[model samples]
Target: MIAVFDRVLIANRGEIAVRIIRTLDRLGVESVAVFSDADADAPHVRAATTAVRIGPADARRSYLDGAAVIGAALAAGAQAVHPGYGFLSENAAFARACAEAGLVFVGPPAPAIETMGDKIRARAAVEARGVATVPGIARPGLSDADLVEGAAEVGYPVLVKPSAGGGGKGMHRVDRADDLPAALAQARREAAAAFGDDALFVERFVAEPRHIEVQVLADAHGAVIHLGERECSLQRRHQKIVEEAPSPLLDPAQRAAIGRAACETARAVGYAGVGTVEFIVSARRPDEPFFMEMNTRLQVEHAVTELVTGIDLVEQQLRVAAGEPLALTQDGIRLAGHAIEARVYAEDPSNGFLPTGGRLLDVRWPADVRVDAGVAAGSLVGAHYDPMIAKVVAHGATRADALASLQQALSATRLPGVTTNIRFLGRLLDLPAVVAGDLDTGLVDREVPALSADPVPDADFAACAVHEVPSGHGAWRADGWRLAGARGAVLRYADGDGEAVVTVRERDVVVERAGSRAVVPRAELADLEVRAAEDGATLWVSGAAGDRAISRPALVRRALRASSPELVSPMPGSVVAVHVADGDEVALGDAVASVEAMKMEHVLRAPVAGVVRLLAVVGAAVVRGQRLAVVEPPTDERRP
Candidate 1:
């Protein structure tokens, strides 16, 4: 059948928008993309057949502007609007607005969205229908004291979940009454910031539970089916970083049970298009699961489900919205081989996994894997959206094979500019628990100490000889440069906070303080750090240590920047809020100010207790390492 709409407007940004555009293109349907000023040149905007500017960089004025988005869609002659996940995907008002405008909303019914959008209402709805829900309060407004009393009744160690949002924002675990108030406040603030809703619902915190979610596709007709289940147990900060379909923990019987339950929930809600039913699978119980929440939109890890199901869920969404019956049934659905997806986010796992922003100086991926990338080389991972830059999915006959293939893909992938969780993903895939398919929401958190404890390779300096001078030096001369008095001269290199010197003499290289040495071949002197034209030679001159490669120039520049004794903005973003001012005394680790980039908040904190001298004001823009404030230690204070 022809597409339900001649053109569907993708009211979103980033990889998901691009992903939907690709599907629309494949279906011979024209695609429209509405981008904010911040996303004018984004890959999604470029991929769309028609593009329209909505508003400024601020999401509220742009992506979150329902009227602006509707206007853009109508102006572009779009007959449908696809809110790809976040912004307005589950917004009942937006759904109603689209319906009133006579535009197809590629999602569940507005009533369904309204009913399930609030976690509290969703819990009550599912519970009333006999679906198991975590024990908690569904009521909205109550004093903190009353809420604490509710928590006591429900039991301590309750989870404070924002009733209005998803993606783990404002999700807090309260173990004590004192912590409940703070958790509730923070949850409200984050919920308001992320979803424009501060209402929260308290739930029983299921300890060490595996997050299993069923992907469901329903049509305007009565057909509803489940596309197996995804194991989303591996996460940090409640955001799923790694996901796989056909959870290892579930047997066929259990899978069928969960899938049936997911279908039942969708059937009860009259859900349409694509949605997910998330459940917390107790590690203690294993088979029995409690309903957590439902996402009435496409998911970030949809690729893995697609890989296993061989169904174009987005196409199904469009078709379902187009008034067509679901093409497949639960009887037709069958899980294929295993597939694993690792989200490549622009974040530094070492530093509390804070979002990192920068122009992608270099971005390359392995050819064998399916890479749903949102950014290319030169693409700016700004501070106005989620930091997920790309998703790499690999499919294989077995779970182990899929994991291995994904590991190879991640290891081979290179993203040089901003700090990424690529290396962390590789390590995560290798974790003993991860390898054995033993996982829980806390597995990643539990392994943090070991994952981040490893120091940068000691051979980093020697490796920089290659980073400093890439191949093609001496005008195609492979021989090392001849110094005035030596075969190869000593060069300085920095790694993190330390510096090292390496002496290269033609075919031989010597390290000063490392007490390690490796002899280089005269023909292959560009080892370790430089990529050579195909010769089958090893990249690094392997010594007793591991093969290392690092950019000496980047490291040296980093070292020079770190010499400053002032707190600075970590990336290019606008200072949205400030907490401290000049002459304000702050203790170490106190948040002095916060900058918003890529929609993620980066709070600048005092590294040491001192009097702060503010340099940047709220609403001002700052670049990476630009001083935001100078802290004067009291011990070193001047008399004057």
Candidate 2:
């Protein structure tokens, strides 16, 4: 057995890197962080004891470059390397490169990675061990006739997936025989783009399946221990949104059976280190759980497992890499509490969940819960990487308490300038079906309209206005005045819906047609202290909603400016195709340009008809609502 390394290099970024660093520090091991140009100022880079500049923000040159990562590890004096998920985590070549460099790769061996990385081979391996897998095809060179025969054997509504891909990439669902060819081609294209593997396979799509995964830890001694299960039923477009521990759907017997199967599958591969066995649990048949795919490295939702079992998975990985034996037996493990995690992404939930990029003006997380974030307030949410900003996790003695905590944490979060899934998460937590543990992969799609609806109440806007008034000028003082006897500066603000007008007179914020008054207490008013300027009153408001700085005069002007003519650019991407000619007549939702970003294609549509005026052309980069085009209405129509 090799000696334990004194230093380890983290070859990734975001919350996972930070998480690894924390564990390394606790283990008395030095940590090295490698970052691209875009992530130089990231929190994970700053938290590392040593940092290395890998390359540009493009993942291909930095994170995915195994040679560069190995060089960085050697240069930083790291004797081991930890690939924190995504990027090169599952790349067999990366693990082999690390092994060749005499650096202990903190994961399974290269051969193990190769075996489990391929969906077809992994399925075959699991099946050989008598583990039940989804009915599917694993062989290659199948023609349209072969595909039809295979679908008939596997049954209808089969899912076509890339043989060498995960993370929902290169996956297509075919409900009928007519759509099989198109689905196969699309899945192959996506697979080639994502994993450089166009090999495809077919599987029976488990209708309304609960995405459950079992965490397994294995050591060099050939012992594998399954760490219960995680319920990841809440998903959007095959991507997990909310993950919880101690699946509410599983009874003790079912949990034990699934866990045993997962352990047997791990042993079949002679697995080591931390890995996850993902399963698709059928709603119609809870007694059967089909093996999906095994994540060879740590999972993004590992924190839920950590919260429930009180075990730091990264630490376990480190230990297992150091050739240590399993510390605890299966009998000794106990899941104490329920835990839930919500991934806060920099995306607009109302706008097709398109990624948002901007400078973070503010970020305030709940103090009661654990918030693992990789960006700060001033950090830039760029198109260079994943749109996820942070993962917020809450643990409680019961699922209800955990749900409540998650809801409270989401509500307490204060983020401005960039759109987030915070409000959507808040609505989701309060969902009756969710509260009752009745969840499915289609929950988001089914209740999207309700989930995406604006949740800020009218009272919130009124409170925001009153909370915007300058402290010394509010009603807290007998003769409220910033300047002696100066009548509280007339403050005009807009309510939540922007329909009602709010006027602050003599330190009292009056909401039109609303009878209730929110008095600014002297103590609370101090917290809302503001500086009076010639143009406006800049006030700071602190409350359960988190802190905010509001400019009284600017708010009124913004409220009025909201009605101005505006053009919104749909999707986050660079304009790839522009067809509009100035003065050309166009109808509503006309295609202006094709915006390509995040490897997804989106066609920018015009909002109205008139004479089309284009501001951006092909190859020009644009952000959300950056005014890419303008409609002049019709020549006969008069401007209001």
Candidate 3:
């Protein structure tokens, strides 16, 4: 038996760090954690045996700074470093640095990371190893003209993907030849912003494609084994939301074939430690699976793989890093039961899945299944990091049972302040296609409207009223109670554009919205969970109807900005670029500036055709609804 390191520094943060710490503690090893100013009070910081400050909140200065991380490891007297995915997990330079420092890096070699890190190179390398890759045009440097010409030959409906990043950050789909040029420009900008490499490749968009990935572990002694597969087709904008093990779409023979291909791909680069090989399988033809790219580190969905295989992947990484050989052979591995995981993000499904952030007022995790969370009550959910707050993983004897268990777990989850996709995930699982295991990449995007059509029920408004009113205030407080000194017994709350007027009577609470009234008894609503924000300006009410966030209406505030022609930032982020100059004439819906947050870019457009007055400067941080630019109507069309 090989001995694990005495001390290891985890070079990442969030749930992954907590997960690695758990394994390190189980094996009696000291786990060192590194955090930035923003993560000083994070859950992962307190979970580690020892912690060190890295840098500031900006990732480039902290998590992405390889030099800072190496310095921290050396100063902490760590024998090794475990990059738990993201940040520098796939950074070849960082891996080489660790090796030079006489520290074991719990991942593949630098050469392997280099080869598999680039999609263009990865596609070529795997294809040389007799692996079937999806037909596409990939190279180091392809100009816009070159890509446009290649797209025509590769046929329309192609995906433009970045050569360097793994997550679907810079990916775009063009269905027609006319739109290929514009898509290429936007893809290049995003690719450069995300990966510092604007190189792109075009591949044919598979109709009804299913994302299947195989987890494999290899040691430095040249032994590799597969740990089955995971289905990750439930996605929005190419980001996976839900994942399950032992894809229901694959039969026994197909699973073996894909598993063999995954091992062969790993062997092509002499990969060591744990790695996941992704494949794109056509839903209509599940037998023919095409090679996608290899993730050189542990995946976010690795929990589902572990649940089915009964293997501690983090422990395997630690052992492999200590120069251990295969503990189990190919034939000895067994895949039992099934597992499903839902990634809970701080995002609003109803608002185009825009990222949301705030102080978490209260967080209650489910008790039944395994939960990997990065935040706790009073934790700050910021815009500087990935919005995924936690993951809920459930295992059962069968696929149906696992699905049901996951749904129940999600319903029991509660995060008061920040908006999450929990309710939407519960609804997505009930969709006919997802329930029957008939999934595709576009399913979530297509069904977004129906899945996000949750409306605030009147009962929730009544619950908020009960929770917000002071004891001596005659049961309810009106909008003008504090401002205008009016002591009315009616409450006025607003959600988005809708308003609700509530009255608390002796035994019943009456709620009126849009000329409809509903009376709910006080005792009947006693079970509703009411969580107030720290400032008491907002109330989150949870009941059988659903979760709702209500706040007192600002009638005067709304009236002042109702007729203002301004283009505002929809989310809190930094202004990356401005397309138009001050006083430049712009048409309606014209792109004015770009704002980036959580690694996603959003373009702000002019609301009316008029001369532009830019108010936002590049590199300035802005908040949600912060005005970025304004359009002044010409004097001929201006209102007197």
Candidate 4:
């Protein structure tokens, strides 16, 4: 297996790039990384053999710019380009351009991409092959008026999205006739912004369906096979959260049927390289599966398949791209013990799962599981890319064993600086439904309250007081003062939970709150890093329990931001939309503007019902807390 290509250019960023580089290195194939200004110091860039500055922080000008990627590849003297799952990975034109430029595109052929990349066309192809598809209306030249009528025929609840979209971008669930038009418009907006194509369609919305997909591998020699099934039903916002191989919901007959259908669908489109054929399995009709869509590139959840099969999908992808036949046949592919993967994101589970941006102070992954990470302890998470920080996959001999390992892995995963969904994932894993292997796409949203509920232990807050309380401002810094003088510091947050005064007596931390006092272990309070730099107060504690943090300086910054005249960006990102104008009256909960960063959209809302004064324009770059619009209260309800 002489190296297929001397050097392969990784035409993306983040964890996927890191994952690909590891395989390329093992194959003795050098890797070149292309990045924007936001990723000058990213782990993936450093991991590659060499790196090139593609463009600014905005994804369109850098990662999504097909020409720039190819130019960088040529300049780096790379023989091939590996579009790592996102950005331009599924762009057929990009694939054609790479071929036109004499560079090997490490993915499906352009014809196959053009065929399956469009959901409308993919559905037609699959349906022609006798594959079952969800009830829907989609085709070129389909009118909005016709779609509204189509919705009536399809039923009240349906999904609207771009014909050429993946992930959850531009996808909307409309449950009412009145909401259909608005949903379509918003879906088109998102679709256009994400894929540059706004041709929208509608499909019957499946109620609480299981998202299962089959991994398919093919070669130029015409060999193709399915690598079993992956249960990707655990999701939120239509994005997968947890994935496992050899779906617990599938028996031998169902598995064989679905696998055959997937391979049939792949071979139908002349599919090559590695791909995933996703299906929606209704809870009511467990044995029947509906063809949802096909991802022509490697999937984010491909790791679970690798863990179960003990084969490197990336290596196989590379070999296929080099025109080599797959080294293994379907008979040789074996699925062993159960494997589970959990995606760790930079999001606040309690706050409507809003995307979070901040500096990663400390990150420690569990040593037992396989951790694929994109950031380091000092890495900065911005509103310029996807918010996913890492993925943890645990494998065991049995499903129960795998889940136990996954639970422990989540507990051992530590990311103290920025907010994360670790606590939420831990709780989700403990649910009875999950324990019993009964799951659906609606599980997370249905149990939001309990799933996101996180109660901080008293000791964790005491740790925050020790690290965040200013050195001299807090009496705790003073040794037990000579006489009777009480020494303590009051630490408060914007949260409704109020404040607490921590009194330092000898080596112990006495947390006094609501007229009650609880002693905290002195050692527990001093376990992790504490820093109050120009950014903000950072308090981190990683112990046997888990990682937790609350930056008081960040709260103060928010307070100062609230003092401004307008609602502002919660994080730094480019303004994609503005819905209000100067002097326009608006109500609470109205979306005044939408800002996007790291592939997550944050909708700014009116703080008070009043006249709106716009301060930011669409496409304007804004920073954290940058004012976007000001809402003036009515004369009778005005506040100073």
Candidate 5:
């Protein structure tokens, strides 16, 4: 019999917290949710049976405060603590604190966490287990000679990563031998800032490698099993955007090999509960998959495995924590239908995917798809948390079917008031490489422009304008009958760029045609919709071109003009470095200033050669489209 807890405290917020809460509720267990000041009304807090306010919005005071979380758990009489993914999920001290308090930690033991949490030690442990890993050198206080020799042996184009880091932070790719020192220094600085670690290690940079991870579940009874694999090759800045179960590039034998290696790795570490073993599958050869690292906690992409394998990973964690043996054997576990998940973020993909914060005016997910979301309509997306708003998951009998379903769901989904990558996601689903299952880490970088291009067709805009125009007050209203001698209201719309305009009347919509008139009848409007032409809804009224498609809730449409010159800023970010001075001469595409946003540095270049007029001082806070500097082009008389 599985030991049961009277109550469980979830020490995190967002979708994963809600996910754990639902599993707890299904087990007839009371759930206590802790929230920071910013997330007082978050969905996780509302879903839990009991709620407690921790501290301020800063994560160090709230979610990351192990003592505070344990205190709240004790205050609520919770028997166990579940640290959902992220915050304190892999914190060894947090797990120990729970143990010292006589509360069960719903994860691996503290020792396992400490041992595997350190990248250098974990690499050594996995290497002892005879698993093939990339060749690299890990040492502390190594001399420059040592680094040079190590790089010579491992070859150039090596990756320098922090020994105690997660995510893509603290990692740098050095292409040439001369760049190694600077790259190492930068990586160490980032690692120190992010993970409190300055130790660096080098590894052979696998070119165009596909990121695949195998899921392993272990119980206290020493039974561990693998749950297939997830293909997470599509990435931007080392963060996964789309993930799918049963990698399209892997065959049955290759999948089995990877799974076996993953289970063996777990055994070597004596792991327990749900963990992921990430691998760098060489794109040049699909048959070879090398070990990358082990995540001792549940992964963000675990939902895809759950959809395909029909398993509740959180429930398994609870069972394993209670000292129950794994219920299924490796042979018994079978992959079912294909499943795909897309991370929906509150960011603008066109603007370097910077984190966006605003009031969510509207949020709607497809009814037919499974949406794991942390916020709802009217909720504010703030800078205090991750930019991910929701994860849309779709499952089907076949990969093609799953991809197609995900495309349809993405197109139908809507989020207003906050910029999102919804349109970009829809285009990704339709990509030929993605549909054909030919994917790797470099795929998104290669296909980003095409995938992010405007999908609305020109003809659709004309049709929408003509159909939206009001008909006459007289006969044949059901059809297209206009009143005798009546002229309908004149409506105008802009083009895709908002640089040109289109005019629509009761009978026809006029579009620009080679400096002449191009009229489309209202009857043709209905036919365009039936054809499902892209760019239909974004059509600007004739006479206004260069307008962006602004889809509000319930199909309310507006065309927004480009930001004026005074509004030029580095999308959204903190000023990291300022290069231009007021009244300084600058040429077209010259580096004006740089800002750090979304963990990447973006250099705002001058649009035209001119004299810099107004410049924001260093360390100034800026918002999206906020003015940072102004440039006045040289007059004809001033030209050389």
Candidate 6:
């Protein structure tokens, strides 16, 4: 087959860009990659045929700058621009700009993007074509008062959603009428910050909602077909955690009905290229699936659909963009084996799932599964990008086999010097509800306490201590031991259950702790991947158990208190809002400030009821564990 285009420029970064470049290379096309200053050394940059630096580290001046992307494409002598999943992929104006510049945009037309990008108009348009949408009050220019009124009419437990943007950003779930006003305010603030549009609508919240989306393909010749559905019910904070093709909840008849509805939705908007039509199905009524929205470009979970259908969705997108007809008909498309994908994010599951960033010391992936990774060893995971670092996809003849394969793949995946959620994903797959194929959007949230309850294992503590503790043979060692025999150093963390007393000798190491004791050979600990911080205060150890971080207990205890009088930022980010001023009286649990990181907002609240002294300034960058505020008892309330 001839190449879709001689040269194509990718207007995105990370794993999706690499994924697209792989397909472009297979089709015998030259790939051009654009990167910000931070991503100049990213994996995608090295994988492309040629790379260009668009702007500085700030995404606004680089990846999200549609004008800059188009200029790079033209300068590189590229015929088309492929906007992979995020950034400006769904921006209608960007599509129009590409067309006006005589560049083929590998996506739907501008009108189609404009119609489906806005949830309000998309809902109305699809409903006009006899498609089912969640019962809601979605319309343009709905004021706050109008939303309040609509919320009451829609009944309690209504969902406030922004008209523009997807990925569950700017969405709030209000379970009571009194909370609607506050949720609406927060939702509007988030919406405006994220998508620059605060327009919101109210919808009846679907209890036990299961997110199922159908993959559809269209050509300019007016042919649209569905490539089965994916079950994306496993989520955290409204973001998908795991996705799989051929949902176990749906039979042949139900799948056909949902597939038809999805096809109708595509035809309604004249959608082209590969797209996903999302639906919200109630666990009670699995047969009746409600249209959620249509993504104008490829989905992050598109790999799963491609694995099951054995179709290269990106290749198809390229062919269609080059004015080719549908390569396969509805009857020709077939679903073979089951495929599952688990998203690996650079986050600490035990630490409230906050985003983590650092230099990746050692990155290892299993060869048995398909791993699409963005970062590698020596790569810096920064705060400017999303937390997702890679995706592990596996295919098997049965759902159980696929689940088991994914679990093993996650265990074998190792990323040191940065925290990850690989262990948590493995545990989630073992949940009885998940094993039985019974899932809902809220399953992850409800089971977070159990899922993140990771206590530092004795083996991990021993390895960390062995790798960090100084040798006792030297008189000038940090251990500073002059006893009759050699003494070891003790290490502990603020959140650790107990201390690890480690004694490193020439031949073997001795590690003792409460309820455990072990003496292992020094060669064993030396072989493990141990990355120490520059300050030598923390050590990250990666072993068969997974990655674990060990901090110097004394240092952490001195910085933090048992009573917790200070409020600190959980991750490195910018202070977006400060609800309390200096010397303001704040009650316990009162929202004092909010830190924005990785496109998510985390509210830091007062830990004690006292007069608060604010330390964080809005729009100022902060580091993880940086003090943001302090609460001191009033004079009258002071005991002394």
**How many clashes in each candidate?**
11, 0, 0, 5, 30, 1
lDDT of 6 by residue, 1-640 (tens): 3355899999999999999999999989999999999998999999999998899987889999999999999999999999998899999999999999999999999899988989999999899889999998998999989999998898878889989888988888899888888888888888887888999998999989999999999999999999999999999988899999989899999999999999999999888888999999999999999999999999999989989999999999999999999979999989998999999998988878889988887889987888888988889998887889899999999999999999888888888878899889988999999998999999999999999988776556666655555463532334554422455444444335446665556566666776667787766665467778655677887877678777765455533443688888889889988888899998889899989888889988888899998887998999988999999987689876
User: What's the CA error at residue 196 for candidate 2, in Å?
Assistant: 2.5
Best by lDDT: 3
By TM-score, the best candidate is 3
lDDT (tens digit, per residue) of candidate 5 on 28-75: 899999999989898898999999999997677998899999999999
Candidate 4 regions exceeding 4 Å error are 468-497, 514-517, 523-536, 553-565, 635-640
Rank ordering of all candidates by TM-score, starting from the highest? 3, 6, 4, 1, 5, 2
Model 3, range 94-146, lDDT digits (tens) per residue?
99999998888899999999999899999999999999998889888888888
Per-model TM against the reference: 0.88, 0.81, 0.96, 0.93, 0.82, 0.94
Ranking under lDDT, best-scoring first? Answer: 3, 6, 4, 1, 2, 5
List per-prediction Cα lDDT, in the order shown: 0.79, 0.77, 0.87, 0.83, 0.76, 0.87
Query: Which run of 10 residues does model 6 get worst, by summed lDDT?
Result: 475-484
lDDT of 1 by residue, 300-359 (tens): 999999998899889888888889887697888888999999998888777667777766
lDDT tens readout by residue for model 4, 177-255: 9988877877877888888888988899898789999999999888989999999989887888899998999988899
**Taking the tens digit of each residue's C-alpha lDDT, what string does model 2 give over 198-254?**
888889988887889999999989788999999999987678889999999999999
TM-score, cand. 3: 0.96
lDDT of 5: 0.76
Q: Cα deviation in Å at residue 514, candidate 4?
A: 4.9
| Position 271, candidate 1: lDDT | 90
Give me the displacement of residue 297 in model 5, in angstroms.
1.1
